[model samples]
Target: MADLESGEGKTPVIDIPEAVGVFDTFEDLQQAFYDLRMIGIHHSDISLLANEKVLKEKLGKAYWRASDLEDDPRAPRAHFVSEEATGELEGAIAGGFFFVGSYIAMAAMLTPASTLAASIAAIAIGGSPSAVIGILLARRVGKHHKDYYTNQIEHGGILLWVRLRDKEREEMAVKIMEGHSGRDVHVHSWSK
Candidate 1:
């Protein structure tokens, strides 16, 4: 099927057929995302509703629902980050802290007056705060993501957009979304 869809009269040309859905919770949305991937949907082809700032700036709306953006090409998109990616980020953060502490400990050990025990103590002391700070920062990252979903839920439900080229893929997308308890799962004539 042609990626670019054209129809007569008042029908704006769309780049591709797109499926959209509203998920009541983040878990449902996440599950649909994974399932869509299993069916050969590219990661870049899936998008969540953009944040309030984007909605306001682009669509001039403080709030919107899945239906509102079903056919609108100007709707903004948000990137999806997998749980594994978030975990990796958290690990990187904590590991970075440890590396810094080790570096500092090594610097202290270079001093003529510093002994092995003192160096060890330096590592423990410096590392403790670094580790603590890192954990806190990582927690903040996790919380920020959680808050994003919560905020969206409060406004309505989580809106998901799946872009596809063919009718078969579009149907699969709609079914996958609906199976995950998606509300208003539908296909549009176009996508951004």
Candidate 2:
């Protein structure tokens, strides 16, 4: 147990080997559990699997209790997606394309399409700026809210958790989990 503290009043960065999925509601969490299972991703209830001593010592008693779901089976099981299966990364990249595509379509429609080359040129020109801005904006949002999301999970809003197979899988997992997640999805390396 190294010093988990990273900053004052911040959730100590525990060395965990899991990705936690945070959702706003219990239904969303449950749905994710079933959805992942459908795709053959083995998942387990974190509350049932977490080491009580490590949880209590690192995250505090409140989080420990929050992680526990044995007392109430009806309550959402804080799911931990295993290091298997896959998630969509194309969605994030496609979002950038879609955002830019809309403007390109509108511009092409409003202006005269005298030639296919002209239309193509308009799309290329318009799309470059829009795509850059869209991707940057998305990245900014993630950077700005990273802390807020981490705090939310610390305060017991974490609805699900997963241990990705690797970094690439983690990236994809974030996108997929974020799609279903109500609040946020975070990847952490938790020592067993």
Candidate 3:
């Protein structure tokens, strides 16, 4: 509970509901959130930071405003540029999860049902067996490929700093980093 009463010789007292202590300051909190994002934990930190009601109230305005600007076609292209930067950040993180999780599942055959699903989708859509097989095989191969890519990014994929038009472009950058650059994906904004 928050300290409700305290003075000279008296101790603080509280009858309020308990509080969850996380970060003690907004700067520290944002730094932690950014650190997680930088390290491929994309979707993990926002809620934890948002739990700080005061900090959220302050930064939430900026976050929401930025998002709103992204939605406005007539807004300055710089706003959209910021969106791309944000997307690159997200892609780096989520790409890590996607590549790792999908690979693990495929490698373990955790969902032979996915093969069945692919077959059904292929059949219903009149896709060739080769196409379905390729899709499944890609899933299997993509796991190891992505794990390597994520490791590279974690180590020092610095070019991911280049701005792209959208999230897909950022994802493509991950592919490029692994295949061609011999480095981790890097997408640091100028602000970084």
Candidate 4:
């Protein structure tokens, strides 16, 4: 664990990719947490922070303190694919849906069924594949985000941040923080 304090009353710099939001009061911090939860992110994935002294004194042994000497083998690891990989995955999913849906719809057209029935059947069958793909994607993305956030927490003290699972969620998190007058709102990338 590196020293979390650069100077008195200042927050330490983080090296990993992360989204950070700073609040003036604990109330504001709680509100940000509430808003994030309302937007579908859970409380477990968020971290709250105060100044260095406050955090060190209040959290005491409860806080995660890292040494600058060597990597902590006990530190949590992020196992999910990177955000860039997820983007590529989403593209592949879209292409697959397009190709598979078109083929299924065309094949259904050849059957001796009414136009409406064939269209409905095609849509219903096509949705199955989409649902399956969507589920797998969501699970992997969610796990990755959660694990990365956990790793961040274990590496340093709580810093009032959120782990973004997608672009829309990232945007919404920034908006919510800025809307609440959060300062130093930054997005950083973490590498393992």
- Tens-place lDDT digits, model 3, residues 1-192: 223222223333223211111222323333433443463533311232111233245334332232222112122211111223444554555455555555554544544556766655544443344345545555555454435334323422211222333455455434543444222234422111
RMSD of each: 3.9, 15.4, 19.1, 13.3
lDDT of 2 by residue, 16-120 (tens): 455555565444655666665555555542322243344455545545433442222223322343212212233365476656676875678566544777776
lDDT (tens digit, per residue) of candidate 4 on 1-192: 123432234343334434675455434555777788899986556654333344346434444543321132122322223355566776676666656766777677777864987777886777567657665775675565445445434654224667676778888888988787776676645311
Instruction: Give the runs in model 2 whose Cα sits over 4 Å from its true position.
Output: 1-16, 45-156
lDDT, residue 26, model 2: 42
lDDT, candidate 3, equals 0.34
Candidates' C-alpha lDDT: 0.81, 0.50, 0.34, 0.56
lDDT tens digits, residue span 17-85, model 1: 788888888888889999999999999999887777878886677667656665566667898887778
Cα error, residue 126 of model 1, in Å, equals 1.8
Q: What C-alpha lDDT does candidate 1 achieve relative to the native structure?
A: 0.81
| Candidate that beats the other on lDDT, 2 or 4, i.e. the better one | 4
Q: Count the backbone clashes (under 3 Å) in each candidate.
A: 0, 8, 9, 7
The weakest ten consecutive residues by lDDT in model 3 span 72-81
Q: Which 10-residue span in candidate 4 carries the lowest summed lDDT? A: 66-75
Model 2: worst 10 consecutive residues (lDDT sum) = 81-90
**TM-score (C-alpha) between model 3 and the true structure:** 0.18
State which candidate, 1 or 2, has the greater lDDT: 1
How far off is residue 175 in model 4, in Å?
0.5
Clashes of 2: 8
Count of backbone collisions in candidate 4:
7
